[model samples]
Target: MDKTTTAAPSAAALAAGRRAGWLRELRETFTLAWPLVIAQVAQNALITTDVIMMGWLGPKQLAAGTLASTFIMPFLVGAVGLISAIAPLVAQARGARNIRAVRRIVRQGFWATIILSALLIPLILQVKPIFLFLGQNPETTMLAEQYIQIGVAMFIPGLAVVVLRSMLSAFNTTRIILVLTLAAVVVNAIGDYLLMFGVFGLPRLELRGAAIATVVTNLFMFVVFLAYVLNHKRFRRFHILWNFWKPDWHHLAQIFRIGTPIGMTVLAEVGLFTAAALLMGLIGTNEIAAHAIAMQSASMAFMVPLGLGVACTVRVGYAYGRGDDEGVRKAGWTALGLSTAFMTVSCITFILGAPLIVTIFLDPDRAANTDALRLGASYLVVAGLFQLVDGAQVVAAHALRGLSDTKVPMLVAIVSYWFIGLPIAYVMGFTFNLQGVGIWLGLAAGLAFAAIVLVIRFAMRERLGLLRRTL
Candidate 1:
C-alpha cells in the first residue's frame, strides 16, 4: 500500500470511467442518428419517385421537371437551413428544462417559416422569367413554369414540416419522423401513378399531376405531424401551439440572426455545384451526363453524414445548454468520429465500385452511353477522394451550430467553395483541359478546405470564446 501502488489503481479507475463515458456517448449518438438517417433516405425516395414518374411522361417532361427542380432546390434548401435553427434552439431549451422557452422557440420557428414562405413563394413563382433571362429554351421554360406553379404551393407546408421535425428531433423522437416520411413517399408515388398516367379513371395531368402529388404529400405530412405534436403526451405539455398567433419578435429575430448565415452557407455550397454543372455543360454533353450520374451517387452517399450532422447539432446543443463543457466535447467528437467512420466506408465503396455504380445509371452495352459511363466512373473516383472531407465539414459545421456559431462558418464556406475551389476548377477544367475530372477535383479541394478550417475552429472553441454564453 505504498504511494505508487495507490496512484496506479486511482489512474486505472479514472481511465476506466472515461472509457465508460465515451461508450455511453457513442450509444446515444447512434440511437439518435439512425432514424434521422433513414428519414433522410425516405425523403430522397420521395424526390426520386417524382423523377421516375416524370420520366414516364417522356424525355421532354423529364427535362422540364429537372429544370424546375434545379430552379427550386436552392430556395428550398436555403429555407430549410433557416428552419433548421429550430433544432439547436429547442434542444438547448430542453437541456435547460425550460419548458416555456421551448414553446416560445417553436412558436417563433413556425413564425419564421411563415415569413420565409411568404417571401420565397413569390420569388419562386417568378421562375419563368428568371429562366428566360438565363437563356433557357422558351418551350422548356414554359413547361417548367407549369410544374412550378403548382409545385410552389408545397413550399409552406414543407417548411412547416421542418419546424415540427426539428422540435421532434430535439426531443430524441425521430422514429415517427422516419415513419411519416416513408408513408409520404408511398402516398406521393401512388398519387403520381393515378394522376400522371390517368390510372383508376383519373384524368392525365402530366407534369402538373406530379406537382399536385408533391403538394398533397407535403401537406399531409405537415397536418398529420402537427396533430401528433399537439396531442402527444410528451409534446402537448409544452403547449407549442397554444399561443401560435402571439409574436415572439425576440426569438424570431434570433432565428434569423443565427439562421440567415446558415441559409447563405447552404446557398454557397449549392451554388458551387450548380456552377460546376454549368462548367460541365461547357465541356461536352457526355461530360454533363457523366456529371449528373456521378453527382446523384455522391448525393445519395451524403445523406448519412447530413443526418449525423443534424444529430450532432442537437447533442452538442444539449451539452452546451447544460453548461457541461466536457459533455459538449464528447458529443461533438463522438459525432465527428461516427461521421468519419461511415464516410470512410463510403469512400472505399466509391473507389472500389465506381464502375458498378456507373453501370447502375448507364447501360454498358449501349454505344451512346459508353463515353458517359467511362467519364462517370472517373468522376466517382474523385468523389471518393472528397468523401472524408465532405463528411467532416458538414459535421463540424453542425457541431459549431450547437454552440451558436454560424457567421464564421458561413464566411468560411463562401471563401472555400467560391474563391478557393471555383478558381482552381476553372483553371484546371478549362485552362488546363482536364475538363470534368478537373471540376470534380475542384469540388474536393473546396470541401477539404472547408473541413480543415471548420474543424480547426471547433478545436479552438475555448480560446475563441465560443463557450462563454453557454448556460
Candidate 2:
C-alpha cells in the first residue's frame, strides 16, 4: 500500500527469477541435449586422451593408433549403426506401456550383438595383411597390427554395452550412456597410465598397452551397465533376463531389415575415410601425417555433431512413440537446428584456427612436412564448411530411422558418401592435382547432397503421417 516501499520487488526476486529461467532452460536442454552431449564429449575425450597418452610412446605409436582405428572401423561401424535399432524399438514399447516388449527387445539386442561380435573377432586377425596390402609403411603396419589384435578382444563385451545401453536409452534412461561413458573413460585413463609407463608393476606394452587399456575399460563399462539393467525393478519384475531369454526371430528380422540399410550406408562413409588414409599413405608419410592430423582435428569436431545426431534419434523416437506427428516434425527440425548452430561455430573455429589445432598433434620443429601444414589447414577449412551439412544429414537420417524408413536414407548416405564423395575426392586429389584439399572437397559435396536429400525425406515422411504410425 505504501507504493514507494514496494521497491521493484527487490534485487533478490530478480536474481531468483533469472535463476529459475536458467534452470528451466537447462532442464529442457538436458532432456534434449545432455545425454547426447556427454556421449559425444566422452568419446572425443577418449580419443584425444588416447592420442595424448600414445604420443608419449612415440610418433610410431601415433601412426599405429591411427592405422588401427581406421582398419577395424568397418567391423565396428556395422555394429554401431545397427545398434540404433534398439532405441526406437524400445522407445515405442515404452510409449505403448508394454514392459514385456521392452524386455524382449533388450534381450534380442544382446543376442544380436554377441553374434556380430563373434563374427568380427575372427576378422580382426585379417587386419594385418590388409594394412600391408593397403601400402601402410611396414613400421606403422607392424605397430598397428599389435594394437588391432589386442584391442579387438574387447569387442565381445563392447558390443553388448552398445546394444544394451541403446536399449536403455530407448526407455528414456539416456543419462546412463553419459554416466557409463565417463566411467569407461576414467578406467581407460588409469589403465593407460599403468600400462604405458609400467606403473603398478605392470609391463610396458606401449601401443599394445593403449589397446589393452581401451579393451579393459570397455569390459568394465559392460559389466556396470549389465548389472544396472539386471537389477532394475522394471526389468526384474518383468523377468527380463529370465523370461525374455528366447529370440524373437520376427523382431530380429525386422531389426536387420530396418537397420541394414542405415548400417551399410554408415559403413560405406567410414570406409571412405579409411580408404582415404590408405591413399594418403601412397602419397608419402609427410602427406599421411598431415592428413592424420587434419583427420583427427575433424574427428573431434565430428563428435559434437555426433552427439547432436544421437539426440536427434532420441527426440524423433520419443515423438514417434507418442504418436505425435507434429512433434516428430518439430523435433527433427529442432535437432537439425541445434546441430547446425553448434557446427556453424565449430566450422568457423576450425577454418580460422586449423593450423593452431594441427600444431597440438604435431611437433612443428620435427614435422618434416614440407607443405603438410598449409595443405592440412586448407583441407580442414574446406572440410569445416561442410560440417553443418555433415551433422544435419546424420541427424536427419537418424530421424528417418525413427520414422522406420531406414532403407531410403541408407541408400542416400551410401550414394552420397561413396559414389559421389569418394569419386570426387579421388579425381580432385589426383586427376585435378588439387592434392589434400581435393579429397576434402569431395567430402563436402557428399555431405551437402546427403543433408538436402535426408531433409527432404524427413519432410516427406512427416507429411505422409508416417511419424505417428508404426511400421
Candidate 3:
C-alpha cells in the first residue's frame, strides 16, 4: 500500500514537471512576442486612425475610403508577405553565423520590393475602371478612385518599410520597431488632424488629406528604419549596403521562388476579405460600412496573433538552421499555444463588447449610421467565433514558412479561401437570403478549415523530421 501511494505521487510529480516546462517555453515566447505585438498594433493603428477621421467626415467618405483601401490592400499585403521571406532567411543566417548570406538575402529582398512596387503602381492607377467593372456606386467609385490615386504614393515606401522591419525583427532588435512605429502613429494622427480638418492654417483636404497623411507617415517610417539599419552597430558586420544598388540574379531567383508563393498565399487570404467587401457593396452602402467597421475591429484584434506568428518565424527558422529540430518544435508549439490563449481572450471581449466597440467608429446620435451600427455589432459576433481559428492558421502558416515549406501552404490557402470561403459566402449571402450575416459565417467556416489543415501539416512535418529538409 505504501509503495502504491508513492507511485501515484511520482506520476503526479512528472505531470507537474511537464506543465512547468510548458510554462517556461510560453514565457519565453511571450517575451519575444510582446514587442512585435506592440509594433504591429501601432502600425495598424495608422489605418484605424484614418477610418475614424473618415467616419467623422460622413458615411460617403468613410465608405469610399474603405472601398479604396480594400482595392489597394491585397497588393500591399501580398508584397509585404513576399518581403517577409527575408526575416526567416536572415534568422537562419544569423543562426549559422553567416553574415554573407544575410547580406545577400536582404539585397535580393530590396530588389524584389522595387519590382513589386512597379507592378503594383499600375494596378492602383487602374482603380477607376476596376471599380466601374465591379459595379460600384458611381459617386462612391469616383471618390474611391481619387483616394487610391493619392494612396499609390505610399506603396513603395511602405514595402521598403516591410523589408527593413523584417530584417530588424529577425535579428531580435524589435525595440526599434516599437519605438519608430509608435512615433509614426503620433505623426500620422497629428498629420491627419491637420490635413483632414485643415487645422492651424492648413487647407482642409478631407479624404485627400487622409491619403496625404498616410503617405507622409509611410515615408517617415521608411527613412527612420533605413537610417537605423545603416547606422546601427549591430548591422555593421553584415556590410548590408555593400555595392549599394546592384542586382544579383541568382539571389533574386532564390527570393522569388520562396517569396512569390508566400505573396500569393497572402493575396489569397486578402482576396477573400476584399471579395466580401465588394459583395457588401452590392448588398448596400450600409452593409459595406458595417463590413468595414467590423473588419477594422477584427483586424485590430488580429495584430496580436500576427505579431506572434512573425516571432515564431524567427524562432523556428533559427532553430531549423541550427539543425535543432526539438527546438523548432518547442518554439512552434509555444507560439501556437500562446496565440490561441490570447485570441481566446480577444474572442470573449469581442463577443461581450460588440456594440460598444462598434460605437467607437461612428456617431451614435447620427441617424444615417443607425443601420451600419446595427450590422457592425452583429458582424462582430461572427468575428469573435473565428478568432481562435484565425489565430491558429496564421501561426501555423508562418511556422511552415520558417521551415521553407511555402508552396503547399499556398495551395491550402487557395483552396480554403477561394474555393471554399467565397462560394459559401456567395450562396449564403445571396441564394439563401442570409445576406451579410451569412457572408460572415462563411468566412468563419473557411478560417476554421484553414486552421485545421495547417495544424495537421505542421504536425506531420515535425513528426517526419522534414522541417530541416532543404528547399
Candidate 2: pairs in clash: none
For model 1, how many clashes? Answer: 0
Judge candidate 3 at residue 424 and give its lDDT. 96
TM-scores for all candidates: the values are: 0.94, 0.89, 0.95
User: Number of backbone collisions per candidate, in order?
Assistant: 0, 0, 0
Candidate 1 residue-wise lDDT, 1-471, digit = tens: 699998999999999999999999999999999999889888887777776666555445655776777678889989999889999988888888877888888899889888999999999999888877866667777988999999999988999999999999999999999899999999999999998899889999988999999999999999999999999999999888887899988889888988898888888888888778767755655675677667777887888989999999999999998898898999899999998999999999999999998776555776777887899899999999899999999999999999999999999999999999899989888889999999999989999999999999999999999987644
The regions of model 3 sitting more than 4 angstroms off are 1-24, 463-465
Per-residue lDDT over 110-164 for candidate 2, one digit per residue giving the tens place of the 0 to 100 score: 7777778877789888877887876678888988888888898877787788777
Quote model 1's TM-score: 0.94
TM-score of 3: 0.95
- Residue pairs in steric clash, candidate 3? none
Error of 2 at 449 (Å): 1.1
Error of 3 at 212 (Å): 0.8
Best by TM-score: 3
Better lDDT candidate (1, 3) = 3
Candidates 1 and 2: which is better by lDDT?
A: 1
Rank the models by lDDT, top first. Answer: 3, 1, 2
